[model samples]
Target: MTHTIRRLLTGTALAAILAGPALADETIDITIVNGHPPIFLWVKHLTETFIPTVNAALEGSGYTINWTEAYGGTLAGVGGELDAVEDGLAEIGAIPTVFLPTKVPLQNVTYNTPFGPGEPQVVMEAMDALYAQIPGMAESWHQYDAEYLGGGFALDNYILMTNFPVTSIDDLAGHRIAAPGPAVNWLEGTGAVGVAGNLTTYYNDIQTGVFDGVIVFATAAAPARLHEVAPYVTVTGFGAQSAGALVANQTWLQDQPEAVQEALRAGAAAYQQAYIAEQTQRVAAAMATIAPDEAHLHTLSDAERARWAAALPDVAGTWAAAADGEGLPGTEVLNAYVQILRDAGVPLVRDWSQR
Candidate 1:
């Protein structure tokens, strides 16, 4: 009995010595917010990809996170994501930079130079390369007290969804068309009055005749059932857009352990992969629904597409000039973006960098 008791005590001491410190695990609480609801593919990725990826990455580490997710205006409204993170209302968020162009102007590089590539992955890759090559691009997020993680721009090649059939560019004359973000500029020379609007309100607004049509992607139009309200989907091919990103408060991010920060970045990368895959599939599937005759879908003729592109003012140059006035490397980014796409063999409709 004495020998047994002595052995037990020795084992206990050995265990305590081996433990070194208390090894108390740390738990981090983070709140993620998005202006748009989960129905949007990007928002869905927050729950399905970002959160899960981060959680999985943290496993077996000495730290874990307890996530509190607030989406769809629960925490912030459209164009309010930057403020939410800057004010620490939320530690992290997927900010749609298209809505906050003044704050994240560099992020809108794709928006300024439109009609480049149709594939989201190509644009995403170019943007990623820009973030690495251009210091100012990443610094734009720092200005908002946020750190940018890898993700994508969700907007695919935009089309015009209208109540009236659009057989030609002239068909849009004097019609009040809804356009989200800088896309309103795309209608400048088209003779269409572009009213500012978004996906969430496109249906009701169109139903009530607030706007005759909306400039939107097929994937979004299909899911929102815009076809039910507006049967005409004109494939204008305005361009795919890199419009949003996952950003975390810089103060909060800087305070985290290295492991936690890495996990967050990993989660963001996963989000980019998942988003591109799902968005590609959705676009293809949505195209099937928008048939030639049944859905009143019309792909603008090549000649007409070029005519429309030529009629537009030097919008990309104007955008780059504005950024330069604000002390950003606007022209450099613009030139690099166009060059990257050109090198990748993306057939651009117009040479936006020529101006």
Candidate 2:
């Protein structure tokens, strides 16, 4: 063949190769588990936003994920998701760090330091900053055989729901109120009996007289219909909290291709933003639904909020000391977290780190 003809043939071959698929199409199966059902925004977004976001990110790439979702105690109950994911029962999970305070104490910084900010976005941002600033934040998950992706899912400002009216801190006296995990500490000096409870059992437990009321976030209260059982709604402003994040089994994540890992992380970031946006918008509506009658709703006075904050013991200091005893940087996490909120101009009834 002539030189020109040979060159033309080579160019044609190159064009054909470029026109074909860049890489072989690959499919990966990932199971995502959560204790709560789809009704909860966090779980709902995993299916509606996270999964789709991952798929969208992999569009041009030659990879796709076939997701198996186990929620509402199908594979694990509330507070059991960390174990499920760590044990490799599922490839990924939305683990609520609030429940695993002992296992992942660093992630619970917001919970220990209450009366900060009522906005979920602010709390989420602070947690995200903490994760980046403190090495122990991510190490906490690694030690559990899980990889922490950046969801930073946060609960809205916590409120009080009671069967009876609560005009002030005195009203909580002689009442048995249920709160989840460390939030139970918020009741320390309020004269109320604090019982450990979660959203799954709040309504039934209250209705059955197991507890007279609950410390809960509005986003979940309306859907759980806590209003029917506890008609009085008091905006306590105990502050929004970092509950959990998207996590993956460490081994499972390490075994995946780099592209797959990036996609999952990207999906997590999108899920966080979407979940918080939807949750913030739903807060007011949920409060309205929970307190349809004007007489049933009450916003605690600023003075009363300050009084309640002062009434509690130094829960943050105590928590930090315990974590420090475990050889973690609990004090640094606390101070840094509070500093972040202060820098952001979030009003605080009391500086928790100072105590």
Candidate 3:
């Protein structure tokens, strides 16, 4: 062949090699479900930040996803997320372990041991590390046929929103106070009656006198306008909580292309960062709107906070022991999480692991 012809052939081969990866690209379908609607900050981040981040990362990659978002109880109601993913109704979900205490007892360690760390960033860092370090921690999700991707602590700290001002613990006598999940345990020793309630019905419940007030996070209570009804906001420092997690169907995840799997994992990590950043920023910004008249924010004296924490039963020990009985490293996780808080200089109202 002539030199010119040889050069032409070489150029053609180079062009094909350059086009190979793009030609190999594939599009896959993914269905994401959240029992709760996008109104919640976490779910909002899932749709607004998580999905966009995943899609952006996959751009120009060999795999693209056709996402189907099923939220707002369209596919499953609250507490139905675990089964929805396990049954293959959705490929992934934001499963709130707080709601599935019986099904995923181990993940509730944060809820069980309260008043440790009030910062969401601190709790999130500790929880994320435990999920990686402790044996069988992630396997808790495996039991439900789901893979844990990533999760974060939802609130900065728990507070009280009530119609009546809480001047002292004695003031809670004979009153009904609502809390979500194991949070009711925070109210155990106080004279207040703890009722199981969630944000969706808090307004109605209080309006109908189902409960006199609620213990909730400031970020959430502000947006939901809990201040409108229960104008007295007491900063109880009940500690931040591990509310939910990003999980994918184990079988479906295993069958996915390697790139797709990585994208899902990447998306979850991004979601955690986005969520914590928003929560951290939101606490001050949201509270700015709920000032004196609209709502009164009072911090429970450190002495009072410690007294409340000390008065509660050994919920952490009980929880850990129950987990150990079921063949899990509950004690190890509990210790590690508490130590993480201590190392971060978080003021603990009670050292749960020590008890």
Best by TM-score: 1
Please give, for residues 100-191, the per-residue lDDT of candidate 1 as tens digits: 77777888888777666878888899999999899998887887798887665557888888999997889999999998888788888889
What tens-digit string does per-residue lDDT give for candidate 2 at 220-339? Answer: 999999999999999899999999989999988999998899999999999999999999899989988998987999999999999999999999999999999999999999999989
- lDDT of all predictions, in order shown? 0.87, 0.92, 0.84
Candidate 1's displacement at residue 344, Å, is 0.9
State residue 315's C-alpha deviation in candidate 1, in Å.
0.7
Q: Count backbone overlaps in model 1.
A: 0
Error of 2 at 74 (Å): 0.5
Model 3, span 1-355: residue lDDT tens? 6999999999999998987854666888888888766777888988877788888888877788788999878998878888999999999899877888777887888899888688887778888888878868899889889998775436678888899988678789899999988888888888889998888789889988899999888788877888888888888888888888899999999998777778778888889898888888888876666545533767789898888888889999998998889998889999998888888888777889987
> RMSD of model 3, in Å?
4.0
Please say which candidate is ahead in TM-score: 2 or 3. 2
**TM-score for each model:** 0.94, 0.93, 0.91
